[model samples]
Target: MRLHRGGRLRWPTIGLAAVVGIGVLWHGRAAPALPTAEVKTGELVDFVELRGEVKAVKSVTLNAPSSTDGDLQIISILKNGTGVKTGENVVQLDTVKLQRTREQQQSDLKRAEAEIEGAQAQARLQEEQNRTELMQARYDVERARLDVQKQEILSAIEAGKTKLRLATAEQRAREAEQKLRSGRAAAAADIESKKQKRAKALFEVQRAQRGIESMTLKAPVDGMVTILPNWRGRFFGANAPEFKEGDRVWPGAPLVELPDLSAVRVAARVDEAERGQLSLGQTAVVRVDAVPDKEFTGTVSDISALAKIDFSTWPPPKNFDLALRVAQSDPRLRPGMSATARVAIDRVPGALLIPVAASFQKGGRTVSYVLRGARFEERTIEIARRNREQIAVARGLRAGEKVALRDPTEEASRR
Candidate 1:
């Protein structure tokens, strides 16, 4: 029943209209539209991508081989980017001081030679004089012995004065013997001292020769000559420029570097999140940004067992570095070229896969929508494997099923 409007029997008419309106409202409410998806079988793959750099297989910063004794002067850079053969002179240090040292050493050596000669002559002369003196002393002793013998004979004849004279003669003979022994010993000591002086002089000469040879720097291997720069614009051998044209350098300064560029390998950093999927001998596709059209193929040659921390700044950033070997190297590929690398982690052969966005969670399991006539229905599906872009459907889905592509929020608004 309904309230009467302004005419006879309006109550019955109003009640009938009310019942019809309720029926229309109830029938017009449609089921909420649900998003749907289809099941399909396809291949899936997992990959880890990282930014890398193209580098020489062997590259090193040449350090001065000698210690920093003084300001090193670059005499001359033999060849820049010039291919030098092994044993070739890459750099020439200033040999002024070296030359002066050599001259001084030569002078010292000459002086030593003269001294040795003088010592030898003196030793020979002294030995001859000692021999003469020894002979003379022996002659004198013999004469004295004869005299003592004569005196003794006279003393034996019973003359008191003759006995005293014989005693004095015996004393004089003993003194001559002592003088001869002392002269011989002094001569032997002088010869030994002279020999030692000669040995010391010879050692100094050898040392000087070695120092001179060190001034000339030679290439250790056949490679390109890269002149390393010092704080000043001059490029010298490793360590510091220890010599000028005339400056003498001490031993062991790094003066040159010979780098072999037969092959190139890239040392790249891979994030820890992707480290688990990476392994040795995996194929890598590298693209050098400098040479965009050229693609280089490589394999994972090595992986760092431990993570490296960058302590240069506060709170270190951690990363796992790896080395990728270019199977085929091009001459144009140089060190420090920016590159991109793709490392394949896993691949599925002809498996059912779908866009990751199409899959949603329902009751702790992945689910998707399946279009049913004019509406959509939610169907729970099992995910065997997944990546950021796609997921492999394991079960609860079939091929040719249509799924909604609209945003879930839009679908809810429609409801």
Candidate 2:
């Protein structure tokens, strides 16, 4: 009975060992393989992304003229953003002071005119006196000539008598001719002096007229009237001078901004490192945060030749700014919109492409898991073009080649 019991125990132990070995073999064969996808010839593009803001293509800031001062009072205010025609009154300074000044100037001008008239009268009187003197001198000269003729006849009659008489008559005639020439020169000088006085009075009147015109401020161009705030914080409250009515301003101070709506563009800043990859006329895909559902196409219109340096409280920062024009104009577009842009740098045609996820880095080279028969094998590939979504494999990949989409965990199980 003991021998029979021993035999039974041995058979059970052997049966258990065989079952354990078969279980291990079955588990190994049943382990799942890594996830995989096929590599195929397709098109791929490489691009760079940048954050930017939308702004008007053309904008001008209106400034106060240099001739304005704080003492100039604002008499009237045109509503902000009011469309105005050329030469329309945008701001009217308290012309009361200017009007008073002009009135005083007018009085002075009248005084000047009276003085000019008086000067003219004096000049005419001087000319008449000169003419009368000249005429009297002429008469004296004629009388001298007649006397000299009589003397000459007498000298001829008495020619055998006295030489002293002839000499005295000739001397008197010469003296009278000299007096007439002096009177004529004096008359001409008196007329010229009156003409000079009249010219000076006319100049004074014109100068006063210009001062009056300067007091009235008019719009220089056909655009909206935007008022700028005073620098002293006296006119528009304590807030920074952005826009307001009755703000005191100096000449050339920017008071308004006029944008040409016909042309619009998006101005964006690109990272300094990525600026080299961008160029004018490059196509871009833009997405505005305000309208996220819609995407717009644009072209790189302009690029800043220099990088921007931070001069504000936030200092020591730099970035290159770029401008892009929208492919189509939309009336809904406005300035100050936040946007994101992607510029294509390069593209490959008919290249072997695969999901970026499937590619892994190993041994200083990019690699992907190629599936062979029932198992995945690693292959080093040459990447030609790559973007955020896909990679173009230049070598070690072919059309219709199967590659793993995810890392292989089954390999660990096999090991």
Strongest candidate by lDDT? 2
Off by over 4 Å in 2: 1-63, 66-81, 85-87, 90-108, 142-241, 287-294, 334-341, 346-415
Residue range 122-160, candidate 2, lDDT tens digits: 656765665666566566556555555555567565553
CA lDDT, candidate 1, residue 145: 57
TM-score, predicted candidate 1 vs. hidden true structure: 0.58
Error of 2 at 324 (Å): 1.8
RMSD in Å for model 2: 8.8
Best model number under TM-score? 1
- Across 1-415, the per-residue lDDT of candidate 1 in tens digits comes to 5555576677678999999999887556553454445667787877778787766677543444363246445566564467787777766665566566667766766776676677667766766766665566566556655655665456555455455555655565556556556755765666566556656666766666665565557777677765432333234332332223433333454444455567877778876788888999998788888778788888899999999984434566688989988877776665656788887788887778777887777669777776665456677888889876778888866778776555443566765
Instruction: Estimate TM-scores for all models.
Output: 0.58, 0.56
